[model samples]
Target: MDTAVEEPQPDEFICPICLELLYKPLVLPCGHAGCFWCIHNAMQGLSFSTCPICRQKYNVCPSVCSPFYYYLKTMYPKTFAQREADIKKEEKDMREQSSPSPTMPEGFDPSSPASLFKCEGCHKFAENPGVPACGHLLCDECCVLEKCVVCSLKITYIPNVCASLRDHIHDNYAGLCSSGPLSSSGGGEVRDKFFKVEGPGVKIQMIGDTTARVEIDEENFLHFHLGCDMCGMFPLRGAVYQCLDCPEKVGYDLCSTCYELQKDVNTGKFNQTHTKDHKMVKRPFNVTKHHLILANNP
Candidate 1:
């Protein structure tokens, strides 16, 4: 009797960003799916955001797709469990490295009005707050933006006023609710100050003097029609790393940064059978090279 574990066959369950099993996956308005953190981190929040795979423009970051989350969990328990453990360890390491020190006063009251619900944008008590797709509560009128100021998640649709929270504020903190609007700044001012809209398509900018960094120009660009699986960089510029062992039509590829940093067990984004043991080759962005890779793999 063979008892060896088998790899998951369904490619849709794989996250495009991390190339791993979709953990806490959020389905975008464009109907594509990616891990919640992946989607959140991918968003620049300064302008319109686009889907990693399809390049569909959107402004809001949506909540976790409950059905996809549970279904993946139930259908592929072992794979999902392994992914969870790996992600947890990674998060723990990150937190330990950058965790901030607590600065609570000696006699802090968690139940106080000031300590209760507060808008993430203005830091005022969210009297008449609206709930966005990311589920973070912001005060009315403060919710207007291309991206959420709190979580930096793109705001796809207008946040609806949370009736329950509105009622709660009305019942408990009626004085604050009836006082005036929570934000001192206008929606236009907030939009201007924080959320400036840049062009929608592929964004290019300069990082520093370094020509071989994240910010590169068309002169330094290589891969014409490829994307980095880890960082979700479309039209992957600079050094592109192609997975030699991935057996998918949409070959597993990565940018130079992701290749160096992320070397974990990731199933390829487009259902490719990529594992940690697989070998990768660095290549320039050329149609011939891309076609050759697909031909060899197929």
Candidate 2:
């Protein structure tokens, strides 16, 4: 009996969408990398594009981040070549798999357009437009408008293709991918715990909005529950406190009651244990309120 051997692939080198090695790899905001063509095609016509595997919103369109690409090409040439072949096959399969969308506009060519990016500022198509880190596009004339249309953060421009349109130019792809994942498991969980979010957050007076901003609704409340480290109560809608300390820098939240009595000598509501000498930043609020103080019995 003749038995065939299975080829083992580096898990990090695999793209979930094509189920193959990444070709012209693009490192997504969700940290998942995939074939540039596969990703752009997968995201077409969607209101919002997200990671195909994790469903994390991909607000920014990614280029082939240099480090990872370099590793795949230079360090692991054989594997990289195999992955490239897989990408071509996957692409062909995708084209075959795609049924003409009933709602597709008349005369829409997915391949020709996916590579073409239009500048929002000038409203023109571009071949080599600059792509900002935030995934917005900019044409040559408009690349100078260095602000992300989506995020409003300052943009770094490359002065050629628009953000989404850069996929059209094959020459731009090159890089060294990061080393293998530290642990096969917990990669996603660890990222979720600390990934930076983009939103309209509350601005602190001293630190300014740049260093510290809390994302809240127009009513000034967080989307998630932040429990008070001091009183151990969930500060549901109250003004939460931020500890500018070592471990607490990672989000050791404080409730309003503890905040009000933080300076108390007897109650020890604030500066106790790890919180001692920690400077606290308070989230802004609109509640018209008063603090009722209790006298200490000596």
Candidate 3:
């Protein structure tokens, strides 16, 4: 029996312009093959009219009809058709991808009103209309005002006055005086008087039924006292030396002999003195009295 021989397959054609498989094949004057669309696009705006493959100058374009075109058209018709179809499909897909989606919001659409809300307090445009308690908007004042919404108290502006209001009112009605006036009852009249004349720092007052005022000027070394004279007494070497004459608290100093005698009396050593000797007794060395002294240096 005789066997049938197999036919050789045709070689695939490539486009010279894109270096790819030829689709809608067109042949240049120099016999080079390329896709018709690719060649047309390349030559669209070019001034030089020539065959790209052989550089042969062409004064007028030639007819594209040729035997090679028919051969490719009949032999690989499906491949040529598929390539043309693919190019169209790819172009359609790119255009679809580039076009904006219908779901996306348009530029500055009025459907959402929140984008137009503005703050009333600061007169600044904002996304919300509500005013903050601090009376500041995002676009308005840089700093927030510390103010009470109900009372309208500017707390930040007058902090000291605001803080002192309650205390001042309370102390006024409560009858609670400061230490400067109260210490007078305790024979602090001299210190209190000195402090009043000087300023507000350390002061003294006497603690008794008849209040006395004692002011002390520590810087100037001055002392003053006001009280019933009967209560005023100087402490000399642990013994009280009464100021007999003065009605207000008065200042007194002790001599060396009287101070030694007072010390002996404090140690339980009694010295009997007649009325004449008592009148002639020398003063003690150290005497404790309400007097203003230099506090900083002392």
Cα-based lDDT for every prediction: 0.55, 0.43, 0.30
lDDT, model 1: 0.55
Off by over 4 Å in 1: 1-8, 96-298
| lDDT by residue for model 2 (216-278), tens | 244334323344443333223446766665342224555555467454321111223344566
Query: For every model in order, what is the number of clashing pairs?
Result: 8, 19, 33
lDDT minimum window of 10 residues, candidate 3: 187-196
List runs of model 2 lying over 4 Å from the truth: 1-8, 85-184, 188-298
The TM-scores of all predictions, comma-separated, are 0.34, 0.32, 0.25
Which is better, 1 or 2, measured by TM-score? 1
| Winning candidate number (TM-score) | 1
Winning candidate number (lDDT): 1
The per-residue C-alpha lDDT of model 1 at residue 17 equals: 90
Error of model 3, residue 85, in angstroms = 1.9
Off by over 4 Å in 3: 1-12, 44-46, 59-67, 90-298
The CA-based lDDT of model 3 is what? 0.30
